[model samples]
Target: MASNLTIGQRIAWYRRRRGLSQEVLAGLVGRTTDWLSKVENDRISLDRLSVIKSIANALDVSLGDLLAEPSLFEWSDDRGSHSIPALRAALTDYRQLSPMAVRIGQEEPPSSAGLASEIAEVWKAYQSSLYTKVVERLPVLLAEAHHAERFSHGDARHAALGVLGQVYHAAASILTKVGEADLAWIAAERGLAYAQESRSQVVTVSLLRSVTHALLANGRYDAAIQLTSDAAALLDDDLPKATPDLLSVYGTLFLAGSMAAARAEDRATTRAFLAEAQESATRLGTDANHAWTAFGPTNVAIHRVATAIELGDIQVAIDIGPKLDTSALPIERRVRHALAVAHALSLWNRTDEALATLLDAEKMAPEQVRYHYLGRQLVLSWIRRQKGKPSFQLTDLARRLRIV
Candidate 1:
């Protein structure tokens, strides 16, 4: 956690996270290793704002991300990460004010279309692994959504609540990625509640899959699978009769269920869900971003790779891994697929190949892979399992992630 770290400690943390030695980081910022060590150990104070900005930029984090009290893995039952506390507090504050009273607090009123576009753009940023930017934008946007909700009763109200739900859902997704599964669930449930209020099947279904993934991440396999199954049962129609949006949602549901089943080693269930997802993909045509989910033929292929890994069938995963056309996917999904392949490679003791796979993922979205708990753990495990002095590639990966 960054809460109590001094500037120097923060620098050291970031440096280690990037797998940089004092010498390496010093070189990047054009300083001596001794000088960098002194700064990291708090021997010298970083008094200039410009210097601080430079350090943060070199680390490829925002000044706020550098200085903010980010809870890397600190957990609260209802709030997993630091972000949840802010969200919970903001939500509590909003609960006290009447909806009408909240409308007056908007910084400036925006047109419905304009506000909708803003929310959409926020989602785009989020799906691209721009978590820092998302965290920066969510507060104002959620508050504005509340304001809009208070003053409108028709389609505008649905639009506003939909945005609010989506914001919470995005929060859940990022939280889950950072290892705060509990907080992720809280955010997801809040999103699902708002989805219900908006009366949007698409939103609600999307949330169901999201929460399912969170549950699966936390090792609640049965609960995860059940959530998707129950959600599917709620839909009054089958895939063939469903709208494109509904089919998309169902496709994601089955894919998530397939993951959970694979984790449970229920091969039968896994293949069943996999088949169903492919069917939904067939119905929807190639990859389509319905319900904000990049569900389609390409995603289906990606999930097959993941399921193969989960089932401990590394060869199967290797065979399917090359068929992915992730260019059509959001960066987040692309990184996920790459990491899955990396994991499979690691299982086969293909250490260099695994590192290369992870590097490819980091190239796609550095922040997403670098700070992600699973990827970090994978690299650490790689370091531990190496039979001799680590390979340069392994050391480079570790140094880049700062696990060494």
Candidate 2:
């Protein structure tokens, strides 16, 4: 008699058949090898429906196939037209309907083409939404499309690479904001690799910038500066005069270098880098002549405020912060809130006020808020030690944010 197999056992068998080691499979699915192992061994359960779908897709099996027992299938009337192929078809149908299923209380029928288009549309919307500096939902959308197996063909693979790169970049940013620098670094590196494979020079440049940002977040100022310089040099000027993508990339790199220099306390170098960024921003036009038209004056101003905060020039940060029209800025690039709050609190010697500002920023987006909070906490801790009591609420905020 054939033995009954749990989902974990089925996953293990299919994984081995696909000739993928746990580590390799885990990387593809953005999971840790240990977690995959535990799931395979039944030591842990797959509670998230998304994880289950991802596993099924990676194994090229149906959810039912993974759940079915060999002996029971042979003995049941329900076995008619219930081969792996049929089960796979059904699984595809279910996965395609996932997004709609997640929305209203209605159960919609699935369409392969419709699912692909929906995924593409949602991905574009997510990218657009990044400018608004809001993105707690991007990761979920990317993961859903990833598990839906909506990206298997050549064109789909290219799209997947682009989506995955953006997802990883966003994930890295969120992780860094939450003070998970190590995890952020890993995600950024993975994103950069995928962007390169997609041959999307613009996306690759963005991913590289993200990596530099991660390095800076981790206090690796020198490394971040070096990486930003290298990325800048790699931008080919011959690409196209109308290509704002390359120009936008250069602007971002310059901003990164400026931040790094500020961290290193090199005032002259920071000013020089900021000047370069400003010049690049000025050159960007409304015509299709630029590679990334997204890097406008607002973006430059946002960076200026950030660098000012980093350099401990509270007055400059305060002056520049309000000048920025954040309404035009991307959701992902909204660094002003933390910068303004931190600068005001620090300069006014109102540590309590600064802590509150940081807390407010955190409430906007915990992941993004953590970046400002970490720096503020470091400064506050030193100040508290010098004084009698711990005035700033860094410890409390850190605990609430799960940073400690």
Candidate 3:
């Protein structure tokens, strides 16, 4: 019986089958012969998905045939001597779970022997979570995926790349939540490059959208708009089906454009963009997939209210705000909560009620609340400046809302 071969041995086997020495193979693949020698000797590591595919193709063998070993044990100098066992154990724990359990645990299981299908499934689940913003569990999932990539061969390497791209995108998103926009952009760019290498158009679009969102959040709205336009142009003339999954992204981009117009105080442009978003929502039809249902009619209503508030159309904001559904919104989306508070204050001219709403939102998500609540604090200060004494109830609320 043939002994189980490590990835390095498989590469050596393929190289020998082609009747090419390490020097010749290295030249064909555009690498120094020493690099190929180290790979064959298991002295170096390979993680890039594209390189693995190139080797598999050159050897005229399926990736699965090249990576048939069920287990891989290896040494790595860069990760510290102890890191390999820890990583292997982690991968082992990951592989033991059923797919449903993996979902519940918020992790992607190590891919089974076949590569492409498994990676695609994991990518689908990851995309679904993005719409609902339940991505807190992504980092651990991604770390395991990186471990799996180290030993992948053939189609497995492609699968690993697909998984790595998802991991990068998820990390970028988490970084954005923690206020690290620069790192978020870098991660996003890396993910996009990998997705392109994978030849996955859907993943490419998703990464571009992430990049646009990060740019918009960082106040680089012009760049954000340009990126979105370029991505849209790259898509074929055919539009993707109006699934809620796709609509959430499409709707969010429209909302971002409206927000940009509002920031510029371009009332007409803002209204047009909001109208476009509402139209997109209407086109989505009423299919309620939890993953896609996040950006529903309520989101459109909130955008309208926000545009009105920004345009100084207080009456319009008041009229539309009460009709908007708040049930779908997570308590952590504090900017939306602030919009609710602003609308209520305008409608009743009741500082007390508005103060209460703001206080409640601050309690729910204090960190997120600060972004728009700072403006609310300024408004309260102005009201107090004009009045001989601040509303005592409002003052109490302000005390609670202050970060320090």
* Best-matching candidate per lDDT: 1
Question: Where does candidate 2 have its weakest 10-residue lDDT segment?
Answer: 67-76
Q: Residue 313 lDDT in model 3?
A: 68
Task: Write one digit per residue (lDDT tens) for candidate 1, span 1-404.
Answer: 53435567778888899887888888877889998898876555443334565677688865444443333433346543555456556555645256446534455555557777887887798779876666656666667666666667788788767767777777777767765666677778778888888888787788888889778655667787788778878885655578888899889999999988887777898898899899889888888887778899999899888888777777998888855679888998899898888877777768678788898898888778766755765666666555688878768876676556
> Which portions of model 3 miss their true places by more than 4 Å?
1-109, 112-142, 149-163, 198-201, 240-242, 266-269, 287-293, 332-340, 343-350, 363-367, 370-402
Give the Å shift of residue 352 in candidate 1.
1.1
> Candidate 2, overall lDDT?
0.58
lDDT of 2 by residue, 170-238 (tens): 656655554445666777887788788767777788889889988876666778878877787777464
Q: Looking at candidate 2, what is the lDDT of residue 352? A: 60
Poorly placed runs, candidate 2 (over 4 Å): 1-156, 239-242, 285-294, 322-325, 330-335, 350-404
Clashes of each: 6, 20, 1
Residue 278 displacement (Å), model 3: 2.3
Error of 3 at 163 (Å): 4.4
Q: Which ten residues in a row have the lowest lDDT in candidate 1?
A: 66-75
For all candidates in order, the CA lDDT equals 0.74, 0.58, 0.55
Kindly give the stretch of ten consecutive residues in candidate 3 with the minimal lDDT sum: 127-136
